[model samples]
Target: MAASKKTLEQRGFHIEVLNLINPLESMSYNLLQLIKDAYKQGDTATAQTLCNTLSYSLYYNPNVKDPFWNNSAMSLCNALILAVIDKCIEEKTEDKICMYTVANMLSELGSKEIVIDKQGNTKNVLDIYFEILPADSVAKMQYATSNFAKGGTTRGGIFSTTMSKLSIFTFEGIAKMTSRNSINLKRIGFGKSIQGKGTPRVRVQIIFPDGSKESIKTDTEGRFELNFKQKVKKGQRIHVMESETKKKMIVEVQTINKDTGETTYKVVEKQDGLQIENIVIFEKPIAVFMIVPDYDSSNHVIASIFIRQLYFVLSKYAGLARGGKCHREVVFLLDEFGNMPPIDDMGNIVTVCLGRNIRFNLIVQALPQLKMKYGDASTTIQDNCGNQIYIQSGNKETAKEISEKLGNQTINSLSRSGKGLSIDKSKTEGIDTKPLLTPTELMRFQEGESAVIRFMKRRDNKFEKIEPFPILNRGKTVMKYRWEYLGDDFDTDQSILDIDIRSLHEYVNPRDLIIDFFPKQEEESFEQPEESNVFVSEPKPVPIPSEEDPEEPQFADIDEDIEIPEEAYASEPVSVYESEPASPFEPLTLENWKHKTAEEFFETHRSIWNIIEKQCMRQWNKSLADIQASTMETFIDELKILVTTGEIDKNIYRLINGKYGEVMDSLLEKEGVKEEV
Candidate 1:
């Protein structure tokens, strides 16, 4: 958030940020793996939901009014999923597709990614499409005669793999161009490698049934469709020619001699080749994808998908199921809350996020905007929020709503009347109630004046109602911004702190909060996966247990013991803090604590020992302070664990909390720590 990276460095925060538009290179988020992880955990629902979300992202456009496009998009999305799956299973490879890859792939034949099939085979995704496009007339006629595929009991098993991909090739009976459409007519050869024909944007030639030719260039994902005046007839010829070419041009001349004279001609032709550049982009810990106001609109789809995924991840990791609060908290500060797409079922998320340590701060012009976005659930979302800040705006509706919520304040009114200096004078006093601030007055509030409506405020793990009040900028109306208050004496006329207001929004990818899944992206060099075609040798012999070496007890399926590799286990337990002892040490137990001297006890329980030394050693150098309640709890917990190590003779935690002062006095007196009062 600070302008100076150097200043942020001094404060111990590494800044690695990227905007939303071009996030794929920097994010390296393996969405493919995330989907599989959900499936692996038997949460097939979550995996399906992710697929559905991607489908919506693929077809969503704020401007579009047609629902048909959205439906078609999901169909296309599933096809892409199957395409990727078949490729991975055939090749016996793991998933390497990411969200960015998916984004580009959804538009075309998707990327050539690795997927794992149940039977364990690796594959090239394009080859699955290659199967759809039969090589010669014989293969083509055979496929046409059949209904897409040969029967295998039912319509949706191994044949379903072919079913999803067929959607990509034919939309209204006309097949489009794909990476696998040509491949130099060789499904597998020197030129058919994923790298050789990998570039999505390639020159291609399409030959129609009428013997007419059309050349259409594809987008980065090699996505392009044709306008079919009529549905293509069955058994008709539609040919796609791969025209991949190198940028290098070769110059040649052709000289022809005739009766009149010899004519020399020069021509330039592109070299028939392709260049591959595999530049690896490292992943960043922080990424800020700005949802532009114009609604670049596509970003909303991406943001919505990202936010939903983030909530899913956080809920699983730190929600009530986690048993306790996480070490760190995640906060979403969303501005223009209404402009963005509605986060699905956000009302439920708002109501139950407290214990999870996940918070959402929504900023909007008024309540109506939220209502527009989330419908009736807007009320649930708003009411669940414990705190609300209202600043004066031109909208009288919002002002009136706040005024009514503020209620009425009681006041005493006194009236005295004496008409013409007559001897008699009458005075009347009465109590009455009136709105704290009328709608008109509320709407006319000065800048920096704001009303705070609060409820169920938590402090010390207890809930209390906070009275609504106005934050009047110290004295109601006479307020200025930090920069204006600076009086223009400072350079740039801003505050002393190096703050970059532009970059203040800390839009962290929720995955960054916990996951470190891709360490490969951190490498400074590019490396290819090792390829091999080899077989494993015979298994090593096992040492059977004899009567002298007692056999282990038999376990049920899941409880069965498996041998772990020697290198897998750590030799020693690592300490939490950097300043811990270099040599190995065991925690002191109650049995040893009772017999040991103060010096020996302190050495073993060094957590307690270090604090004593810090106070005694640095008293002259710095101010000595009592340990914080939190730090004390940690030390006492350590002592309790040691007490419970082998046997639990007593409740160490309660004993320590209750008699700590007396114990401290005795221990200090024995250690010769002189008292000062």
Candidate 2:
């Protein structure tokens, strides 16, 4: 019997242990099951609550062996709690939640609360933490205790704020004594404030050694991880600009101290380039002149009068030098350009110059003497007689000689009027037809028009007239046209006009087209019309009152029978006889009242009787004239009753005295309180 009792006691003790451990475990199992159901069904808050209960239960579990159990359970619970919290956060983004505490809990947890898709087979929560820092004791401890609350530390770095179109400019200088280069440029993520979608473009400009500038533009997302693209040196300046009309910003370059690791950055101030005006630059000087003759001078007469007369026709080309690629300061010219100095002693050339880019050339209409005196090879072929133009020439030999020199032939005799025969470049057949000139040669050319010329073909030594392309001696090129420069004869330059050469690619933000929803407009157009018949329908109508009532007393019996005349009763109310109540010439004054209280006033003017009774005025007064003017016998009697019943107080007397001063005067005269004032 003793042996059997001992065995029974041992069995009961085992059962007691099982019971003690099972409830906590069972409760946790039930809570987890409930949470799993909530999580699967999308009941996030319920899931979070069940998780919290499980965590608390785990904390209290006496038989629990894992020291990390509370943290692990709390992490799972917190994740669900935070996920429920995250929804609220996403909705209320500005709300603050303990991210660090949550992170700590997750780090302590050995497993993650998040589920992974089976097919993709992503790393679970614990896997993520382990992958980042497998040997990190603190992190491992956090995960073990808080269930993966630590998360992947690699991804956890900085906090973001709500600022749209965020742009960051990093300024750093490597001060450590080493050969390593450290300065880099980059754009971080959008600020937390950047809510919508758009292609944000960031521009970076770097000013390096020798005052040279380099610029690069970033793609969408405002993210640019900078590595060394070029050599870095000392005294370099870097600038980054965020170019959005709504969020225009400039970020300055900064450097961090090596020892302290302290960094500083300043907001950059940008100047508007377009607003700057009248940019001017000094250029070298060149000569400009029109070849006109001293026609009447006999001593200076040339062999051909027509030759001298044609000088002006070719003088128009003088301005061509001013429009060339070389910069021109000024164009100085007489009849000849060869007379000018080659170079001034100060290292400045003695030729005309414009901006650094303008083209410069010299033009000269010289006689043999002038050519022999100052002409050089650098004077340009066109400056010589190569571009010489010929008009009417009386000498056939001179004309033939000129035509031969120009690679043209004499067609006919010059003996006839309006007809001259010579050979020159034929613009039509790309050959030197060497055609003779008529009145057209003497006419001035318009701006849009140009003269065509067939130059003598030098290739193959062929005597052919080649029609060169009609060059606008004053126009510009394609590149110069990109930037608009609006002034002078610059219109002729192709370089000055923005001609379409290629299709344009523009980066545009998508949110510009989105419609904002706040403060939405209400639609009032679809209101329901009221149904008149539904409310108007009556069930039945009463029959007309019997004609008998002769026995009933007439309403007239109650009325005062002392009517003076029908005309008197029919008369318009005395208010009609009076002009519309005159506007107060001045503010109302109590000095106008003769009566002590308002009751006397209503007794006089019954038109104001309702007002007196409505105001509960016990003692009222009115001017004598006003009392005589209205029917007030009933009003006075009613007011007297109110006073006798003790309804009138000193306050009422004061109110009457102050508010109805004009009416009180008549009442006072009737009462003989005092002479009307």
Candidate 3:
């Protein structure tokens, strides 16, 4: 379980269990636990509840305790689940869970490249779900349900998580057959001969319905049985091939009902084999050790499914026609029973499952808590309980009920009347009815005091009833976890431990999902605000001189303008500043600049116009005058903005800076727009 690892690990038990199957992928394991298993046991109600597990994506009213309140909504969700799963299995695109495996597969952008944003982030399956599904759209799956639902949904998220984490319904060894000695292992072997290629022991592979393959070996006689990691069905194709050479002995079949359908492959005649039966390998069912977290609210939601299904499968097998009752008695010790998710047919399980040899001991703090989760069904559960135990009663309601159930007994009392009135005396015995114990008396029960009420006894079908008895305040001994009380086999609570189960978020390998748009080349450079000039994508940044030094920083103040003829740039253009010498394009002439608009100036002159635009949007109110390059890079920013905003003519500061080697200008100089000293 994702939760409860810490608590279990604290007791020197670190369990890292993840059966998470991506919902977008076809389940390789049994699907019966979710649907068919229940129907087999004639539990249609539970079968439908299991169906609700797949309805995680659907909207549910937080107020609705009953998930089936909106039958149409539930049906729509179930249909989607079945549809997606069917498609995923049908497509079997690497049998991987992804957008493409389901209804909203993202198409590969040319060559195998997946589209990414400027941040290099790509969309996943969850992204598409959120993009199309707006919870508030056809909403009010809210007020329609009871307020017992968690977070405006009837445990939908947990339902999704449970579906994701399923592999074999109830752990590997937990599922049992309907009959004690029932098994149908259909083993199919390749047509490999004892004298075939190499040794007959050489392995052959079987490709599953999903594109994944597994190598299965042939016996000494070139005989082998059919075994599959995934559940096999009638029509699904299974490919047989040689193991080492990666050769398939498969071919297209002519007859498969539809003549126009995609060509289906069959094992080559040499690879085909006969199926042999009656070779059985039975494994004893093992115990399930599940640890759930008490802290998280969703723990109950997750755990409830496991408990419910475990009971369903176990009880179903026990009640089978060929199965003997009480062959394997399964006992459930459920702690904090009231907090667990409300299980379907829990009342029926408690009363009816006794014959199936399954038992459940639900421990809760109070009767009201159980009633809160189970609602009206609590009465059935409580009434059917064979023996109810109370170690100590603090709950007023539970104690009152216990006191009432104890009933009253008639008590005989003798009274003697004697007085100085005529020396006469009389003694009489009378009986009166009084409760064995009052609610107040039971509510004050002390530590170790307890009572057990056995309601009825049933030998086979006949029932024997018992009269109500007093609520006894008998002493009970509790097993302590102290070192003195525990043996060497047990661990004490002196030291605590933990194991973190959450792994790194990075999961998908980009290589599996993408091909590089372009082959490897020189790394591209970006012009960050403080790193390089905005005009160029790659250029030396203007440096600010420290006040302590007072010396000019490189390229901070250019004393002379450097000029070059138009012919010099006719070949490969070079940067005006030598520190970074690669000019992407030639600067426009003065006449061209005068005609260019602000947008044109910024767009043509700057590679990072967007960054400049952002800065300019904020600088409108700030004073751009008298700010020198020595103060900060803003001084250069002001020069660029002045020309771009058309506040001054001819970009006077750029010419004075001598970086662009601009021709001298006088009109702008008259406006006192010269470089700051």
Candidate 4:
């Protein structure tokens, strides 16, 4: 009984054990009483039978059944189902249930069960489900745990606010350090006061390098500080102009420390890369920090916050570099990347950071996780990566995608046919295409094995070319690192003091810095007005020549030698050079052709009218009126001469009449020649 009680306690069945003990106690007392009665009645057989029945009942009590105590598949299934139900109840909420919520709950339960049985008779329920779920689904569940769905602004609000404050503080420190020609003050105070009070507000204007201006006012203490939300880069000048009249004076610095027996005198110099008094280091350096959560941690909300803060800091550094080459390369190796909140503008960074020597090595369990978080943008993100290494994947989809990307190769296929009785045989060869690596082969790769697709930019024939290469190799083996176990040392001091806070506030003067950029008044220049002499010239009228003047030759006199054949002007115009009389055709005149409603007029006159219009316009440099005023006799003479010389075929009229009669009429009308027939 004691052993059974201990086992029940070990298996976390304390409640069941208590219920069993309470019932068994009463049963035991009743059994003793019954045995005594049987003995008194001289019935030994009844007492023995009663004892056996009670013993069997105690051993096989259904109420005290423990799944952990049983070592069988059936017990394991029951335990898993009950565990899931318990988790569901514990995490019940008004919001719609998500797959990730269930997955996380199941994972936690599995962990506890594993602790209870180091060598379980069945596989873990969480592991089984993980393998079954698609990669993207798993990724989304992991992303939800980081609380990124709350929106980027909300998730990163705290970090952004804190960084803004720090940047303002740092800017003030830099101003103080760089103010070489400023007056030193023994003490300075900045305080805000109620409006309409005794203290007066002073307006100050700040002009950024980009020509954007911001106006601010001093507090009751005549001191002011500017807080900027956007990131500020190095060498970005800020011009401060005081609205009120203020005199500028150079300040000197002198320090004496009686306690340290030291005396110092120095002048601040104009320079860049000013350090933030104590917290931040201005020099470039490599840094690494680990972000780990406890095994049973509910979510990675805190870790995600830290990561977001780090991203902002890196972004500031990148901004300082001004999108140019970075002084040093910065690389972020994010392990279990899907488990963190999505970083803002991560896609932009991935696409452009490589040129600035900034790189991100994101490690994920599967590609689906990435796709879940990025959605359609997942493809763009993957495409921008210069190199991709795909290790063995249990996911058929992932393997297939990778295999297809590896490309296809042609192979020889052979086929043979034979009939034994006829002794006839046939053979054929064909070409077939298949992927470089089959999906099955890709998935079957052993541990430490990977297929790498590297896009290398190399100069070929003086031109840069990007080519991809597939490489298969085993990854380097690494030994596990461990530290010796040690008990807590209460006496040891682990505190670190890296910077002195006293020096930060020693020489700050917001008032003097504000006055440094005061607008200076320039003397206005007044020159004597130049003497003005008015000169007006009399207007002269130019003579206009009349069209009928003898100096202007008539169209007939311009080319009078050309002659037109009588047949060309006959009622039915005929080609003069043709042996047979030309077929009757339509006129090509501007007015008659414009009114001609026939498709043939357009087809036949289109080319000829184009030529005539171009020639008239070029010869006279005149408008459409000049083309109308020209004599039709001159055109008819030119057409006859062209036909006689065979330059314009007479058969052209016959063909135009048969195929496009109205076109021929439009052409003749456009040339100012009347089509009588």
Candidate 4 lDDT over 558-622, as tens digits, reads 23454323222112332322244442445334334334333323332334343334333333233
Estimate the overall C-alpha local distance difference test score of candidate 4. 0.37
In terms of lDDT, model 1 sits at: 0.42
Best by TM-score: 3
TM-score of 4: 0.32
Candidate 2 local lDDT, 193-291, one digit each (tens): 111112246554434334454443444644332222233222333333334433333333255432222334444544442111111111112121122
Error of 4 at 242 (Å): 16
Overlapping backbone residue pairs in candidate 1 total 10
The local lDDT score (0 to 100) that residue 64 gets in candidate 3 is: 64
Error of 3 at 134 (Å): 24
- Which ranges in model 4 have alpha carbons more than 4 Å from their true place? 1-265, 268-284, 320-326, 420-423, 456-466, 474-677
Ranking by lDDT: 1, 3, 4, 2
- Model 2, global lDDT: 0.28
Residue 213, model 4: Cα distance from true site in angstroms = 26
On the 0 to 100 scale, the lDDT of residue 671 in model 3 is 28
**TM-score for each predicted model, relative to the true structure:** 0.41, 0.16, 0.43, 0.32
List lDDT for all candidates, in order: 0.42, 0.28, 0.41, 0.37
Best candidate (score: lDDT): 1
Model 1 RMSD, rounded to 1 decimal: 33.6
TM-score of 3: 0.43
